[model samples]
Target: MATHRLTELPADALKMIATIAGPVHDVEMVSAGYNSEIAARLHLDNGTVFVKGLRQDHPRVWTQQREADINAFTQGLAPALRWEIRKGGWDLLGFEDLGGRHADYSPGSPDLELVLQAMRYLTSATPPSGVELKTMPQRMIAHVTDPADVRFFEGSTLLHTDWKPDNVLIVDGQARLVDWAWASSGAAWIDPALWVIWLIASGHSAADAESLAALHPAWDITPVRHIDAFACAQQRLWESIARADRPDEWTHKLHAATQAWVEHRG
Candidate 1:
Protein backbone atom coordinates (compact mmCIF):
# COMPACT_ATOMS: atom_id res chain seq x y z
CA MET A 1 0.00 0.00 0.00
CA ALA A 2 1.59 3.25 -1.11
CA THR A 3 1.36 6.11 1.35
CA HIS A 4 -0.48 9.27 0.30
CA ARG A 5 0.32 12.89 1.10
CA LEU A 6 -1.77 14.80 3.62
CA THR A 7 -2.96 16.99 0.76
CA GLU A 8 -4.48 13.96 -0.91
CA LEU A 9 -6.86 13.36 1.96
CA PRO A 10 -10.56 13.98 1.52
CA ALA A 11 -11.43 17.62 2.15
CA ASP A 12 -13.73 16.66 4.99
CA ALA A 13 -11.02 14.50 6.52
CA LEU A 14 -8.60 17.42 6.49
CA LYS A 15 -11.28 19.63 7.97
CA MET A 16 -11.86 17.07 10.70
CA ILE A 17 -8.15 16.95 11.48
CA ALA A 18 -7.94 20.73 11.66
CA THR A 19 -10.92 20.71 13.97
CA ILE A 20 -9.33 18.12 16.25
CA ALA A 21 -5.68 19.24 16.19
CA GLY A 22 -5.99 22.92 15.28
CA PRO A 23 -4.67 24.49 12.09
CA VAL A 24 -2.17 22.46 10.08
CA HIS A 25 0.87 24.43 9.05
CA ASP A 26 2.67 21.71 7.10
CA VAL A 27 2.62 18.01 6.32
CA GLU A 28 5.42 15.51 5.91
CA MET A 29 4.19 12.36 4.28
CA VAL A 30 5.54 9.18 5.86
CA SER A 31 7.14 6.78 3.42
CA ALA A 32 7.27 3.62 5.52
CA GLY A 33 3.75 2.35 5.97
CA TYR A 34 2.17 -0.61 4.20
CA ASN A 35 -1.29 -0.69 5.75
CA SER A 36 -2.05 3.01 5.72
CA GLU A 37 -3.16 5.07 2.75
CA ILE A 38 -2.50 8.36 4.49
CA ALA A 39 0.53 8.46 6.81
CA ALA A 40 1.99 11.84 7.68
CA ARG A 41 3.34 14.10 10.38
CA LEU A 42 0.81 16.89 10.66
CA HIS A 43 2.29 20.13 11.95
CA LEU A 44 -0.51 21.98 13.67
CA ASP A 45 -0.65 25.32 15.45
CA ASN A 46 -0.45 23.54 18.78
CA GLY A 47 1.98 20.70 18.01
CA THR A 48 2.82 17.89 15.67
CA VAL A 49 1.00 14.59 15.56
CA PHE A 50 1.67 11.49 13.45
CA VAL A 51 -1.58 10.64 11.63
CA LYS A 52 -2.36 7.46 9.74
CA GLY A 53 -5.59 6.44 8.11
CA LEU A 54 -7.49 4.43 5.54
CA ARG A 55 -10.73 5.00 3.65
CA GLN A 56 -13.72 3.80 5.67
CA ASP A 57 -14.56 1.28 2.98
CA HIS A 58 -11.07 -0.19 2.66
CA PRO A 59 -10.87 -3.91 3.26
CA ARG A 60 -8.52 -3.44 6.19
CA VAL A 61 -10.09 -0.34 7.66
CA TRP A 62 -10.87 -2.31 10.80
CA THR A 63 -7.14 -2.19 11.63
CA GLN A 64 -7.63 1.41 12.68
CA GLN A 65 -9.93 0.30 15.51
CA ARG A 66 -7.60 -2.57 16.39
CA GLU A 67 -4.69 -0.17 16.85
CA ALA A 68 -6.84 2.21 18.85
CA ASP A 69 -8.12 -0.55 21.14
CA ILE A 70 -4.62 -1.98 21.72
CA ASN A 71 -2.84 1.31 22.44
CA ALA A 72 -3.67 1.27 26.17
CA PHE A 73 -1.72 -1.94 26.65
CA THR A 74 1.29 -0.73 24.63
CA GLN A 75 1.94 2.37 26.77
CA GLY A 76 5.69 2.08 27.36
CA LEU A 77 6.66 -0.08 24.40
CA ALA A 78 4.79 2.01 21.80
CA PRO A 79 3.97 5.62 21.13
CA ALA A 80 0.77 6.84 22.75
CA LEU A 81 -2.39 7.31 20.71
CA ARG A 82 -3.71 10.83 21.06
CA TRP A 83 -7.00 10.98 19.17
CA GLU A 84 -9.12 9.36 16.51
CA ILE A 85 -11.10 10.92 13.64
CA ARG A 86 -13.76 9.09 11.68
CA LYS A 87 -15.38 11.28 9.07
CA GLY A 88 -15.65 11.98 5.36
CA GLY A 89 -15.32 8.30 4.57
CA TRP A 90 -12.00 7.93 6.36
CA ASP A 91 -10.87 6.63 9.73
CA LEU A 92 -7.79 8.49 10.94
CA LEU A 93 -5.74 7.99 14.08
CA GLY A 94 -3.46 10.58 15.61
CA PHE A 95 -0.44 9.34 17.56
CA GLU A 96 2.25 11.12 19.55
CA ASP A 97 5.14 11.94 17.25
CA LEU A 98 7.95 9.94 18.80
CA GLY A 99 10.84 10.70 16.51
CA GLY A 100 13.31 7.88 15.94
CA ARG A 101 15.05 5.89 13.25
CA HIS A 102 14.23 2.28 12.45
CA ALA A 103 16.29 -0.25 14.41
CA ASP A 104 19.29 -1.93 12.77
CA TYR A 105 18.80 -5.68 12.80
CA SER A 106 22.07 -6.72 11.13
CA PRO A 107 24.38 -9.00 13.07
CA GLY A 108 26.22 -7.37 15.99
CA SER A 109 24.21 -4.16 15.70
CA PRO A 110 23.75 -2.54 19.10
CA ASP A 111 20.12 -1.86 18.24
CA LEU A 112 19.48 -5.60 18.44
CA GLU A 113 19.69 -5.40 22.21
CA LEU A 114 17.06 -2.68 22.38
CA VAL A 115 14.86 -4.69 20.05
CA LEU A 116 15.22 -7.70 22.33
CA GLN A 117 14.40 -5.55 25.34
CA ALA A 118 11.18 -4.44 23.71
CA MET A 119 10.33 -8.04 22.90
CA ARG A 120 11.03 -9.04 26.48
CA TYR A 121 8.65 -6.37 27.69
CA LEU A 122 5.96 -7.68 25.38
CA THR A 123 6.44 -11.27 26.54
CA SER A 124 4.64 -10.50 29.79
CA ALA A 125 1.57 -8.88 28.23
CA THR A 126 -1.73 -10.73 27.99
CA PRO A 127 -4.59 -9.84 25.69
CA PRO A 128 -6.81 -7.15 27.16
CA SER A 129 -10.19 -8.36 28.38
CA GLY A 130 -13.17 -7.75 26.03
CA VAL A 131 -10.94 -6.96 23.07
CA GLU A 132 -11.14 -9.78 20.55
CA LEU A 133 -7.76 -10.78 19.10
CA LYS A 134 -6.80 -13.39 16.58
CA THR A 135 -4.83 -16.27 18.02
CA MET A 136 -1.63 -17.52 16.38
CA PRO A 137 -3.25 -20.78 15.36
CA GLN A 138 -6.12 -18.91 13.71
CA ARG A 139 -3.74 -16.68 11.76
CA MET A 140 -1.36 -19.48 10.73
CA ILE A 141 -3.76 -22.36 10.18
CA ALA A 142 -3.93 -21.92 6.41
CA HIS A 143 -0.15 -21.72 6.08
CA VAL A 144 1.00 -24.60 8.25
CA THR A 145 2.04 -27.72 6.40
CA ASP A 146 0.21 -29.99 8.82
CA PRO A 147 -2.99 -29.08 10.68
CA ALA A 148 -1.42 -30.62 13.80
CA ASP A 149 1.37 -28.01 13.70
CA VAL A 150 -1.21 -25.38 14.60
CA ARG A 151 -1.09 -26.54 18.22
CA PHE A 152 2.47 -25.23 18.53
CA PHE A 153 1.30 -21.67 17.83
CA GLU A 154 -1.34 -21.50 20.59
CA GLY A 155 -0.89 -19.51 23.82
CA SER A 156 -2.27 -16.50 25.68
CA THR A 157 0.61 -14.03 25.52
CA LEU A 158 0.16 -10.85 23.47
CA LEU A 159 2.37 -10.74 20.36
CA HIS A 160 3.59 -8.22 17.83
CA THR A 161 3.90 -10.83 15.15
CA ASP A 162 5.48 -8.57 12.57
CA TRP A 163 9.16 -7.99 13.46
CA LYS A 164 10.31 -6.05 10.40
CA PRO A 165 12.92 -3.44 11.31
CA ASP A 166 10.67 -0.70 10.02
CA ASN A 167 8.09 -1.58 12.66
CA VAL A 168 10.66 -1.04 15.45
CA LEU A 169 12.01 2.45 16.07
CA ILE A 170 15.05 3.14 18.24
CA VAL A 171 14.20 6.24 20.24
CA ASP A 172 16.46 7.59 22.98
CA GLY A 173 17.98 4.12 23.49
CA GLN A 174 14.64 2.31 23.52
CA ALA A 175 12.94 0.31 20.79
CA ARG A 176 9.32 1.38 20.34
CA LEU A 177 7.07 -0.90 18.34
CA VAL A 178 4.73 0.66 15.79
CA ASP A 179 2.09 -0.75 13.45
CA TRP A 180 -0.13 -3.01 15.52
CA ALA A 181 -2.20 -4.27 12.59
CA TRP A 182 -0.78 -7.78 12.84
CA ALA A 183 -0.67 -7.98 16.62
CA SER A 184 -2.00 -11.27 17.91
CA SER A 185 -2.39 -13.52 20.94
CA GLY A 186 0.17 -16.30 20.67
CA ALA A 187 2.83 -18.42 22.34
CA ALA A 188 5.57 -16.12 23.66
CA TRP A 189 8.21 -18.17 21.90
CA ILE A 190 6.48 -17.49 18.58
CA ASP A 191 7.36 -13.79 18.75
CA PRO A 192 11.07 -14.63 19.08
CA ALA A 193 10.65 -17.21 16.34
CA LEU A 194 9.18 -14.51 14.07
CA TRP A 195 12.14 -12.25 14.85
CA VAL A 196 14.56 -14.93 13.72
CA ILE A 197 13.41 -14.56 10.11
CA TRP A 198 13.88 -10.78 10.14
CA LEU A 199 17.30 -11.14 11.77
CA ILE A 200 18.30 -13.64 9.09
CA ALA A 201 17.02 -11.32 6.36
CA SER A 202 19.05 -8.53 7.95
CA GLY A 203 22.33 -10.47 7.53
CA HIS A 204 22.47 -12.87 10.49
CA SER A 205 23.02 -16.56 9.71
CA ALA A 206 20.39 -19.00 10.92
CA ALA A 207 22.48 -20.16 13.89
CA ASP A 208 23.30 -16.57 14.88
CA ALA A 209 19.70 -15.48 14.51
CA GLU A 210 18.38 -18.38 16.59
CA SER A 211 21.11 -17.69 19.16
CA LEU A 212 19.95 -14.10 19.52
CA ALA A 213 16.31 -15.22 19.80
CA ALA A 214 17.34 -17.76 22.47
CA LEU A 215 18.35 -14.86 24.71
CA HIS A 216 14.63 -14.39 25.36
CA PRO A 217 13.49 -16.48 28.35
CA ALA A 218 10.51 -17.91 26.46
CA TRP A 219 12.75 -19.47 23.84
CA ASP A 220 14.52 -21.61 26.44
CA ILE A 221 11.31 -23.13 27.79
CA THR A 222 9.67 -23.89 24.44
CA PRO A 223 10.16 -27.48 23.28
CA VAL A 224 12.49 -27.91 20.33
CA ARG A 225 9.73 -29.54 18.31
CA HIS A 226 7.53 -26.49 18.75
CA ILE A 227 10.26 -24.29 17.33
CA ASP A 228 10.72 -26.68 14.44
CA ALA A 229 6.99 -26.59 13.76
CA PHE A 230 7.06 -22.80 13.60
CA ALA A 231 10.05 -22.75 11.24
CA CYS A 232 8.30 -25.18 8.92
CA ALA A 233 5.09 -23.16 9.13
CA GLN A 234 6.94 -19.99 8.22
CA GLN A 235 8.54 -21.70 5.22
CA ARG A 236 5.14 -22.79 3.94
CA LEU A 237 3.66 -19.35 4.63
CA TRP A 238 6.27 -17.51 2.61
CA GLU A 239 6.14 -20.03 -0.19
CA SER A 240 2.39 -19.55 -0.44
CA ILE A 241 2.86 -15.78 -0.45
CA ALA A 242 5.29 -16.10 -3.37
CA ARG A 243 2.88 -18.28 -5.29
CA ALA A 244 0.01 -15.86 -4.67
CA ASP A 245 1.76 -12.74 -5.91
CA ARG A 246 4.75 -11.68 -7.97
CA PRO A 247 7.10 -11.78 -4.99
CA ASP A 248 9.00 -8.54 -4.36
CA GLU A 249 12.77 -8.63 -3.81
CA TRP A 250 12.42 -8.40 -0.06
CA THR A 251 9.76 -11.10 -0.11
CA HIS A 252 12.17 -13.33 -2.03
CA LYS A 253 14.86 -12.64 0.53
CA LEU A 254 12.51 -13.57 3.36
CA HIS A 255 11.39 -16.70 1.55
CA ALA A 256 15.00 -17.80 1.13
CA ALA A 257 15.75 -16.98 4.76
CA THR A 258 12.69 -18.96 5.89
CA GLN A 259 13.85 -21.96 3.83
CA ALA A 260 17.31 -21.73 5.38
CA TRP A 261 15.90 -21.71 8.88
CA VAL A 262 13.62 -24.66 8.12
CA GLU A 263 16.56 -26.63 6.76
CA HIS A 264 18.66 -25.64 9.77
CA ARG A 265 15.91 -26.86 12.08
CA GLY A 266 15.78 -30.20 10.28
Candidate 2:
Protein backbone atom coordinates (compact mmCIF):
# COMPACT_ATOMS: atom_id res chain seq x y z
CA MET A 1 0.00 0.00 0.00
CA ALA A 2 1.26 3.51 -0.64
CA THR A 3 2.17 5.47 2.48
CA HIS A 4 0.44 8.81 2.89
CA ARG A 5 0.20 11.45 5.59
CA LEU A 6 -2.60 10.69 8.08
CA THR A 7 -4.69 13.35 6.45
CA GLU A 8 -3.61 12.64 2.89
CA LEU A 9 -4.34 8.95 2.34
CA PRO A 10 -6.09 8.37 -1.01
CA ALA A 11 -9.87 8.53 -0.82
CA ASP A 12 -9.99 5.07 -2.33
CA ALA A 13 -9.17 3.54 1.02
CA LEU A 14 -12.28 5.05 2.54
CA LYS A 15 -14.26 4.40 -0.59
CA MET A 16 -13.40 0.71 -0.50
CA ILE A 17 -14.35 0.60 3.17
CA ALA A 18 -17.70 2.27 2.61
CA THR A 19 -18.45 0.00 -0.31
CA ILE A 20 -17.82 -3.13 1.73
CA ALA A 21 -18.54 -1.99 5.28
CA GLY A 22 -21.47 0.34 4.48
CA PRO A 23 -21.02 4.11 4.25
CA VAL A 24 -18.26 5.18 6.64
CA HIS A 25 -19.70 7.93 8.78
CA ASP A 26 -16.41 8.96 10.27
CA VAL A 27 -12.79 7.82 10.05
CA GLU A 28 -10.58 8.53 13.01
CA MET A 29 -6.87 7.85 12.57
CA VAL A 30 -5.89 6.25 15.90
CA SER A 31 -2.39 4.82 16.21
CA ALA A 32 0.86 3.99 14.48
CA GLY A 33 3.27 1.52 16.01
CA TYR A 34 6.95 0.82 15.33
CA ASN A 35 6.70 0.15 11.59
CA SER A 36 3.00 0.85 11.16
CA GLU A 37 1.96 3.52 8.67
CA ILE A 38 -1.75 3.46 9.51
CA ALA A 39 -3.98 2.39 12.40
CA ALA A 40 -7.41 3.86 12.72
CA ARG A 41 -10.97 3.26 13.89
CA LEU A 42 -13.58 3.92 11.24
CA HIS A 43 -17.20 4.50 12.17
CA LEU A 44 -19.76 3.35 9.66
CA ASP A 45 -23.51 3.55 9.30
CA ASN A 46 -23.72 -0.17 10.01
CA GLY A 47 -21.16 -0.24 12.85
CA THR A 48 -17.59 0.71 13.78
CA VAL A 49 -14.42 -1.04 12.65
CA PHE A 50 -10.78 -0.78 13.55
CA VAL A 51 -8.62 -0.62 10.44
CA LYS A 52 -4.84 -0.86 9.99
CA GLY A 53 -3.02 -0.46 6.71
CA LEU A 54 0.51 -1.48 5.88
CA ARG A 55 2.66 -0.47 2.94
CA GLN A 56 6.11 -1.62 1.77
CA ASP A 57 7.17 -1.48 5.39
CA HIS A 58 7.05 -5.26 5.71
CA PRO A 59 6.87 -5.09 9.47
CA ARG A 60 3.19 -4.24 9.10
CA VAL A 61 2.41 -7.57 7.46
CA TRP A 62 4.01 -9.54 10.28
CA THR A 63 2.17 -7.57 12.96
CA GLN A 64 -1.18 -7.56 11.15
CA GLN A 65 -1.11 -11.36 10.94
CA ARG A 66 0.05 -11.81 14.52
CA GLU A 67 -2.57 -9.58 16.08
CA ALA A 68 -5.31 -11.17 14.01
CA ASP A 69 -4.18 -14.64 15.01
CA ILE A 70 -4.11 -13.82 18.69
CA ASN A 71 -7.43 -12.06 18.67
CA ALA A 72 -9.11 -15.09 17.10
CA PHE A 73 -9.43 -16.69 20.53
CA THR A 74 -9.65 -13.49 22.56
CA GLN A 75 -13.34 -12.85 22.01
CA GLY A 76 -14.83 -9.83 23.80
CA LEU A 77 -11.48 -9.13 25.48
CA ALA A 78 -10.07 -8.13 22.08
CA PRO A 79 -11.70 -6.45 19.12
CA ALA A 80 -13.31 -8.96 16.81
CA LEU A 81 -11.06 -9.28 13.76
CA ARG A 82 -13.41 -9.01 10.79
CA TRP A 83 -11.38 -9.18 7.58
CA GLU A 84 -7.89 -9.07 6.09
CA ILE A 85 -7.22 -7.93 2.54
CA ARG A 86 -3.86 -7.85 0.80
CA LYS A 87 -3.95 -5.76 -2.31
CA GLY A 88 -0.95 -4.97 -4.56
CA GLY A 89 1.09 -2.78 -2.21
CA TRP A 90 -1.11 -2.63 0.82
CA ASP A 91 -2.20 -5.00 3.58
CA LEU A 92 -5.47 -3.98 5.16
CA LEU A 93 -7.16 -5.29 8.31
CA GLY A 94 -10.65 -4.68 9.65
CA PHE A 95 -11.83 -5.40 13.18
CA GLU A 96 -15.00 -4.73 15.14
CA ASP A 97 -14.72 -1.45 17.00
CA LEU A 98 -14.67 -1.48 20.79
CA GLY A 99 -16.09 1.76 22.08
CA GLY A 100 -16.82 3.28 25.51
CA ARG A 101 -13.46 4.68 26.63
CA HIS A 102 -9.78 4.85 25.81
CA ALA A 103 -7.16 3.88 28.37
CA ASP A 104 -6.06 6.63 30.81
CA TYR A 105 -2.95 6.19 33.00
CA SER A 106 -3.59 8.51 35.91
CA PRO A 107 -3.15 6.97 39.38
CA GLY A 108 -6.25 4.84 39.91
CA SER A 109 -7.41 1.23 40.20
CA PRO A 110 -10.12 1.21 37.56
CA ASP A 111 -7.73 1.73 34.65
CA LEU A 112 -4.97 -0.28 36.32
CA GLU A 113 -7.16 -3.33 36.69
CA LEU A 114 -8.23 -3.00 33.06
CA VAL A 115 -4.67 -3.26 31.76
CA LEU A 116 -3.60 -5.95 34.23
CA GLN A 117 -6.47 -8.16 33.16
CA ALA A 118 -5.32 -7.89 29.56
CA MET A 119 -1.73 -8.77 30.52
CA ARG A 120 -2.99 -11.70 32.51
CA TYR A 121 -4.87 -13.01 29.49
CA LEU A 122 -1.88 -12.74 27.13
CA THR A 123 0.60 -14.37 29.51
CA SER A 124 -1.80 -17.20 30.09
CA ALA A 125 -2.82 -17.93 26.48
CA THR A 126 -1.72 -21.37 25.24
CA PRO A 127 1.14 -21.33 22.70
CA PRO A 128 3.77 -23.49 21.01
CA SER A 129 6.48 -25.61 22.65
CA GLY A 130 10.13 -24.80 23.58
CA VAL A 131 8.83 -21.32 24.24
CA GLU A 132 10.36 -20.73 27.64
CA LEU A 133 11.20 -17.12 26.76
CA LYS A 134 10.81 -15.19 23.51
CA THR A 135 14.58 -15.15 23.15
CA MET A 136 17.25 -16.63 25.38
CA PRO A 137 16.94 -14.81 28.68
CA GLN A 138 20.71 -14.32 28.55
CA ARG A 139 20.54 -12.43 25.24
CA MET A 140 17.65 -10.28 26.36
CA ILE A 141 19.03 -9.90 29.90
CA ALA A 142 20.77 -6.61 29.26
CA HIS A 143 18.25 -5.47 26.72
CA VAL A 144 15.05 -7.26 27.85
CA THR A 145 15.55 -10.05 30.36
CA ASP A 146 15.28 -9.29 34.06
CA PRO A 147 17.94 -10.14 36.79
CA ALA A 148 18.75 -13.57 38.18
CA ASP A 149 16.72 -14.68 35.20
CA VAL A 150 16.70 -18.18 33.87
CA ARG A 151 14.97 -19.02 30.58
CA PHE A 152 13.53 -22.45 31.15
CA PHE A 153 10.23 -23.54 29.71
CA GLU A 154 7.69 -24.96 32.02
CA GLY A 155 4.92 -23.93 29.62
CA SER A 156 4.42 -22.21 26.27
CA THR A 157 2.00 -19.28 26.29
CA LEU A 158 1.51 -16.47 23.76
CA LEU A 159 2.20 -13.15 25.46
CA HIS A 160 1.09 -9.69 24.44
CA THR A 161 4.12 -7.95 25.90
CA ASP A 162 2.74 -4.53 24.99
CA TRP A 163 -0.50 -4.52 27.00
CA LYS A 164 -0.71 -0.86 27.99
CA PRO A 165 -3.85 1.21 28.57
CA ASP A 166 -3.22 3.11 25.38
CA ASN A 167 -3.80 -0.17 23.58
CA VAL A 168 -6.85 -1.10 25.57
CA LEU A 169 -10.50 -0.16 25.16
CA ILE A 170 -12.93 -0.03 28.07
CA VAL A 171 -16.48 -0.26 26.92
CA ASP A 172 -19.45 -0.28 29.28
CA GLY A 173 -17.42 -1.72 32.16
CA GLN A 174 -15.77 -4.37 29.98
CA ALA A 175 -12.19 -4.01 28.72
CA ARG A 176 -10.48 -4.97 25.48
CA LEU A 177 -6.73 -4.75 24.81
CA VAL A 178 -5.25 -4.14 21.35
CA ASP A 179 -1.82 -3.98 19.66
CA TRP A 180 0.27 -7.08 19.11
CA ALA A 181 3.33 -5.87 17.23
CA TRP A 182 5.53 -7.03 20.11
CA ALA A 183 3.51 -10.14 20.95
CA SER A 184 5.65 -13.15 21.89
CA SER A 185 5.45 -16.46 23.69
CA GLY A 186 7.54 -16.63 26.84
CA ALA A 187 7.67 -17.07 30.58
CA ALA A 188 4.53 -16.57 32.62
CA TRP A 189 5.71 -13.51 34.50
CA ILE A 190 7.64 -11.45 31.96
CA ASP A 191 4.68 -9.85 30.22
CA PRO A 192 3.04 -8.50 33.35
CA ALA A 193 6.24 -7.00 34.69
CA LEU A 194 7.01 -5.58 31.28
CA TRP A 195 3.61 -3.91 30.91
CA VAL A 196 3.92 -2.47 34.41
CA ILE A 197 7.32 -1.02 33.56
CA TRP A 198 5.92 0.57 30.40
CA LEU A 199 3.11 2.18 32.35
CA ILE A 200 5.58 3.59 34.84
CA ALA A 201 7.73 4.97 32.06
CA SER A 202 4.74 6.73 30.56
CA GLY A 203 4.41 8.64 33.86
CA HIS A 204 2.88 6.29 36.42
CA SER A 205 4.81 6.44 39.73
CA ALA A 206 6.93 3.45 40.82
CA ALA A 207 4.89 3.08 43.99
CA ASP A 208 1.73 3.16 41.94
CA ALA A 209 2.94 0.70 39.31
CA GLU A 210 4.41 -1.55 41.97
CA SER A 211 1.07 -1.46 43.66
CA LEU A 212 -0.50 -2.56 40.39
CA ALA A 213 2.18 -5.22 39.87
CA ALA A 214 1.45 -6.50 43.34
CA LEU A 215 -2.08 -7.23 42.20
CA HIS A 216 -0.77 -9.67 39.59
CA PRO A 217 -0.36 -13.22 40.89
CA ALA A 218 2.92 -13.38 38.95
CA TRP A 219 4.56 -10.86 41.28
CA ASP A 220 5.65 -13.41 43.87
CA ILE A 221 9.20 -13.18 45.29
CA THR A 222 10.36 -16.13 43.20
CA PRO A 223 9.88 -14.03 40.05
CA VAL A 224 10.41 -10.42 41.18
CA ARG A 225 14.20 -10.72 40.79
CA HIS A 226 14.02 -11.89 37.20
CA ILE A 227 11.02 -9.69 36.59
CA ASP A 228 12.98 -6.69 37.82
CA ALA A 229 15.79 -7.67 35.48
CA PHE A 230 13.21 -8.04 32.75
CA ALA A 231 11.99 -4.55 33.55
CA CYS A 232 15.52 -3.13 33.32
CA ALA A 233 16.13 -4.86 30.01
CA GLN A 234 12.87 -3.40 28.76
CA GLN A 235 13.96 0.06 29.87
CA ARG A 236 17.18 -0.18 27.91
CA LEU A 237 15.28 -1.44 24.88
CA TRP A 238 12.89 1.53 25.12
CA GLU A 239 15.79 3.99 25.43
CA SER A 240 17.54 2.42 22.48
CA ILE A 241 14.37 2.78 20.43
CA ALA A 242 13.45 6.28 21.63
CA ARG A 243 14.17 9.32 19.51
CA ALA A 244 17.36 11.17 20.50
CA ASP A 245 15.39 14.23 21.55
CA ARG A 246 12.96 12.25 23.73
CA PRO A 247 13.67 12.21 27.48
CA ASP A 248 14.24 8.61 28.57
CA GLU A 249 12.08 7.91 31.62
CA TRP A 250 12.31 4.14 32.18
CA THR A 251 16.09 4.31 32.50
CA HIS A 252 15.76 5.90 35.92
CA LYS A 253 13.06 3.59 37.29
CA LEU A 254 14.86 0.57 35.91
CA HIS A 255 18.13 1.70 37.50
CA ALA A 256 16.52 2.10 40.89
CA ALA A 257 14.84 -1.28 40.64
CA THR A 258 18.06 -2.97 39.51
CA GLN A 259 20.11 -1.49 42.34
CA ALA A 260 17.55 -2.61 44.89
CA TRP A 261 17.35 -6.09 43.39
CA VAL A 262 21.13 -6.39 43.36
CA GLU A 263 21.37 -5.32 46.99
CA HIS A 264 18.95 -8.04 47.95
CA ARG A 265 21.10 -10.58 46.08
CA GLY A 266 24.07 -9.73 48.31
Runs of candidate 1 with Cα error greater than 4 angstroms are: 1-7
In candidate 2, position 185 carries an lDDT of 59
The TM-scores of all predictions, comma-separated, are 0.96, 0.76
User: lDDT of each prediction vs. the true structure?
Assistant: 0.88, 0.61
lDDT (Cα) of model 1 = 0.88
Candidate No. with top TM-score: 1
Model 2 lowest lDDT segment of ten: 1-10
Candidate 1 lDDT, 1-266, residue by residue in tens: 22343446556777899988889888888877577988888888778899999989988888999999999998998789999988778899999999999999987899999988999999889999877789999988987778988998889999988888889999999999999988899899998999999999999999999999999999999999888888988998888776764566778888999999998887
Put down candidate 2 lDDT per residue, 1-266, tens digits, no spaces: 22333644447666666666788777787643433566777877777888877763564467666666666656657778888766656667898877667777666547767777766665556664432234435446566443445453223556666654566677876567676655665567666666566556556666666667777776674355565555556556555545344434544554454444334333
lDDT of 1 at 61: 89
Model 2 reaches what TM-score against the true structure?
0.76
Q: Candidate 2: list runs displaced more than 4 Å.
A: 1-5, 31-35, 128-155, 243-266
Best by lDDT: 1
